[model samples]
Target chain A: MVRVAAHNIISPLGCTSQENFDKVVAGQSGIALRKKGELSDTDFQAALLNMEVLKDKISGIANAEAYTKLEQLCILSLNEVLDGVDVKSERTGFIFSTTKGNITEITNNPHAVDALLATTANKIANYFGFKSSPQVISNACISGLAAFVIGRRYIDAGKYDNVIILGADILSKFIVSGFQSFQSLSPEPCKPFDANRDGLTLGEGVASVVLSKADNTNKACVEVVSGAISNDANHISGPSRTGEGLYRAITRTVGANEEVDCICAHGTATPYNDDMESHAISRAGYETIPVSGLKGYFGHTLGAAGVIESIISILAMQNNVVIGTKGTVEQGVVAPVNVTKENIQKPVNGLLKLMSGFGGCNAAVYFKKHGE
Target chain B: MVAMLLFILKSMENNQIIKEVSIEHGKVLINQSEFFTGETSDLGPFLKSLYKQLNLKYNKYFKMDHLSKLGFLASEVLLLNEGIANETDEVAIILANASSSLHTDVKYQESIADIPSPSVFVYTLPNIVIGEISIRNKFYGEHMFFVQPSYNKEELLDYTTCLFNSTPCKYAIVGWVEVNRNGDYSAKLMLCQNKK
Candidate 1:
């Protein structure tokens, strides 16, 4: 089995880890406002963290124009998480995940972006000197999680010593407008798992986690015992009412005997997404796992959600705590899922993270207590 | 075993695509042979027709989706009738790299840009091309796409081997699918399975 370790938190310099932790655990949020395209609401914002604050922290790495804001976050976050570690081993493989892989570049030049977009994953491998062959996966919102699951397969196949799974995304006009078109963006902070939630706020951010054969003492973490990805084969944009793909993934990874402690729901806060995620979690028999979502605090970081939330889950697990769903104080919306609102601190055995995306693809990843 | 590998390698030196069609002015120039897609539905009918012209029929294949159905359809035709399925024993899905779903991407984005439409925003992605094909032919084999300045033999063989070794799909479905701005398109797929 591939072991996953606790995660390191390194957002923009101004976006402190402790602050991120506090906001998450206290159920507060940092989502800023945004509006473009057909979206009528102008009052809502996203989790707009400033990268300019970290300029002093990251210097000397050669960058490309092709490397948009998301790529910039990737380099910074990767450096923070792997401070002393060297990624020179040929046995190390990279699986870069993102919904819009450098699509911002495309907004500038469609012809070039169309050609360069596919190479963004490999660019990281080349940049970091990773020896193992790299792979790219873009399953819409679940892309990053899918990358993590694929990394598990690679480790299972004994094809790599470690997997560098990075999820990055930036709030460009392209992404913001796209979400706005769907009428999915919340005018206010997202109220995931909350009854009165209106919509979600799309944000900009990136998160990186290094999965290796190493132990917990090696990193800040959890162990990835099982993971699975399946397609609903139902609706393209809408999630399966029965949570078909999600159910299969959870059952396959957690198995019949084990029980999950806390769950990281997709929690896009959209009507359909929240409902779908809640249904899937309950279907996985996680009715009372102190379920929560990060969208309220970080906004919907799209591709970054998988890696970012995985990092959040790892950190919470490492600290023997469970973060509550932010901005879900008033139960006004209809939700079949359980929401952990109060500050719940408990020692958990395993953490299950689930994501659903376009192409009807969905993935569920299970991380257990390290050294198990 | 080494000698056999060498013999196979020597034979691959003669590998090449039989047909390369460029859709200029909405008319297809097979350059070598005539081919493309015939049907359409939730997917793109206009583009699927191109794929029907390129793909030759096979017993195993996945149904087309709005995004990749067209590209898969064309690549399927190129693969079956003129490209590699009939000519070689081993095949590889090495797409010189093209949009998995450009039409869908454009449509989806428009919903967000002009109208509030999440249904349309659902399909803006790239891998829809290869995924559609994998399902169509049950081609859970060695497959990958390379974005390069142009095709290079060294790059192709090296990439193919890396792809083959990464997973367990014996036959590889590989080539390039570029939908030009002029509404013209050209794609080529080849099978690179071991004969020995």
Candidate 2:
């Protein structure tokens, strides 16, 4: 069975999974409001990382200028997990996931940004001395979870024994303004699944996870059970009112057994997204399952959302505590769901991670505690 | 051991593709047959003419960027006869490219300076093309968009075979769709299925 060998998270919440998890469990939010003429022309609330902290960490590294902010976040996040492993082995592969890589570089030189994703992957692989060429998944917000699925498949297919997966995305004027143009950015901190919820708060972060064929005896590990992806085929930008795609994906991943103890949902705080997820969960007969919306803690980190959230969910499973939804005060969806507004102390076994994105893409992956 | 090895290899050979199509500047080819061609300057009109030729009624086609338009056109030509359009939910779509929507990205960046246009911003991501195709065809199957330095057919074959083996996917629409900064575009699409 494929297992999670190691995982690291670098976000506004913290630099390590333990630190981030502690902050999350404490119910502290990283999102805050910034006035116009700062990050954007209009006032917006988002969970932005401390640039001084990131810059200070990068200052000690050689040739730090060669890497962009997103790339630096990726390297810093992966560095913790890459140690004690031989990255130059052919049996090891590197996979990078992002919605936009070095997108901020576009204003400076559009030509260079043309190859930003591929070039960034190569740069990180070369830095780590990986023998194999890297793989990139840029499938909107589901990219991180998609990367995990692809990484596990590679190991199962015997193409590699271990895969290093890194997912990252940074905030920029281009991305923020684009979301503003879509009118999907919340003016204040996001309130996911709440009746008063308006929109999502954009966030920036990076995370890395190592998937290995061999079981890890020295560290905590989560088993990769099954994963599936489906599209709504309803609207390009809007989610299906029926939640058909997400229902199919959740059912396909967990099956009829419904062994899922808790779920980490893609609650973007948008009016349609939360409602769509509620319907999808109920249709899959998982309405009573404990669900947590982590967006209130980290906002929506785009490509990193899936990986970091998955990591958080796996940690919750290990600790046997359901993380609470940070910003919801009242239930919004018509369907019934046990939305966890406060941390639930119980024996957690199987965890479900779900995320959906603009392409009408919905992805669900099931994870179990090791030996379960 | 020898017998088992041969059996495994034999089973792998059964995963044969049914059809493949290629779309490049001013040209569209299916199974090595030239289906359409025109001057580069008229690429937009050419795609429009092709869309009209298909008798498709999807009005969203006009608003799509060049990359999505090319992917939509290629998928239309590939699945026109597959009988899986909007009916089957098991046909997976796996597409890869070298340049991940850089043409539209540049255009979108230009709009961000003035006022980010939602129309242009939505097309900034590479996977938007897959969404366009999925919406048009009503495909709710599995999909992924990858970025590679070049079209690696071996990786495509490996992953497609793996999906057919391990997942519920029966037929996979896989290939490369790319649009460089120069506005030049190429999409090599194929429809693969097991012989069972």
Candidate 3:
């Protein structure tokens, strides 16, 4: 079994997983409404990292100014997880997940070679001396969890014993403006699964995880039991109304009868996304499982969403509690689902993470708490 | 440790190369056999003519960006005749490339100053090609898009083998699809199934 040995999340809430977890448990939101004049001509609500603090953090790194903000965030998050571990061995593989890497640098110059995602992956991998060729996964919003599945599959296929998976994407004008064009950005803090929920608030962050064979790691870990991905084959931007893809992915990961203590969902707070997830859970016979969307706490972090949210879910299990779906007041979907509105204590031994992205892609991963 | 090393070596030997398809210089090659040829000068007209000649009826083809159109054309030429598209939950799509959605990115950037086009912006993601193909074929299966410096057959082989070995997927459509800054693009697809 492949297991998560270590993880780190660099976001607006904090720099480390524990810091973000503390804020989550306290119900303190990292989201705030940034004025439109600052990013664009339109005032929008989002969870943005304090650049002053990020600059202070960047000052400690060598030649940080030479790197792009996305690269800096990726390196910073990767550094936090690499402590006391050596990734220079040939057995260690590197995977970078993002929808758009260094895209902020592209700006209006669309032809720049530095805009390539592979360029960012190579720079980061070379910095850490990964002996194996670096791999980059860019499958829309599901990139993070898809990267996890890739890492696990690589290990199971005996390609690598350890893999370092890093995910990062920033809210640049290109990303924000595109979503705004779709009218998917919420003017207020998002309320996932809430009847009044309008749209999602964009967030930016970087998250990393070190996955190794269960027999090779002594650190407290969570075994990645199974993972599956399915497409809606319905629409590129809109999710399937029937939730066919997510339902199949969930059933493929956790058999129909398998007990799930908690569900960490990709509740972008968009009407279609939340409703689609609720229906999928009900169809899969997991409607009663505790479900929560952390978007209210940190907004939707894009490429980093899956990894950051999964790490937070692991933290929730470690604390023996299920984090509430922030900003949600009342249920909205046709199918009944137990959306956690308050921090509830529960034995979250078996946890499931679900994410659906543009391009009709849906991913579900099941993880079991490893030995104490 | 020795036993584990043996297993790794054994799995490496088990990987098999199936069918290969490459599209470049306005020529489509299925296993190096010339399937279609056109003027490489203009991608738009070339692709449109190819779609017409192939007699495809998916009208949504006209609405796709260059990236998705390229992938759609490649898959149609490679798998449409082999009955690969009709299978659901059995086949997987794994593609990789260097320049990700740069063509559409430029187009989207041009429109951002006045009114950003949601139609163009929706294709900003490179993986939308997978979505386009999925929608056309009704393939609700595992699909992934990667960004590599160039087309590396080894990485494709490893990842495809890993998927077939570890996931529920039995067949894989794998290779490279890229649209560079010059608006020049090429797609190479290989259809492989587990032999063991």
CAPRI-style class, candidate 2? medium
Q: In DockQ terms, which candidate is top?
A: 3
Candidate 2 lDDT, tens digit per residue, A23-100?
999998889987787469878898999978777788865688887777777778888898776798877889899998
lDDT of each: 0.60, 0.85, 0.86
Query: What is the Å distance of residue A81 in model 1 from its true position?
Result: 3.0
Total backbone clashes of model 1?
59
> Worst lDDT window (10 residues) for model 1 chain A?
A5-14
Which of the two candidates, 1 or 3, achieves a greater TM-score against the reference? 3
lDDT of 3 by residue, A1-372 (tens): 898889999989999999999999999888987877636678888888877887877877788877888888888899888875668776788989898787766675666767998988888887777888889888889999988888888888777888899988888888888999999988899999999999999998899999887774456678887888899999999998889999989988896556699999899999999999988999988878899899999898888988999999988888889998889998787789999999998778899999999999999999878556
**Comparing candidate 1 with candidate 2, which one achieves the higher TM-score?**
2
Q: Write the per-residue lDDT of candidate 3 for residues B1-196, one digit (tens) a residue.
A: 5644665566665456567888887888888998888865378888888898799888798899998999999988878567664648888888888898888888887788889888999998999999998888888888899888988877887787777776667678888898886878889998878665
To one decimal, what is the Cα RMSD in angstroms of model 3 from the true structure?
1.8
lDDT of 1 by residue, B83-151 (tens): 333222134455544353454554444444466455445446655555456445433233333344344
Q: Candidate 1, which CAPRI tier? A: incorrect
Considering only N, C-alpha and C atoms within 3 Å, which residue pairs clash in candidate 2? none
**Candidates 1 onward: DockQ, in order:** 0.17, 0.60, 0.74
- What is the lDDT for A264 in model 1? 83
Candidate 2 per-residue lDDT, tens place, B1-196, comes to: 4532443464476467889998776788889998877554355777777787778887788889989998998999999777874745778899999889788989988877687899888888899898888888778888999988889876777677767777777788899998888877778998998654
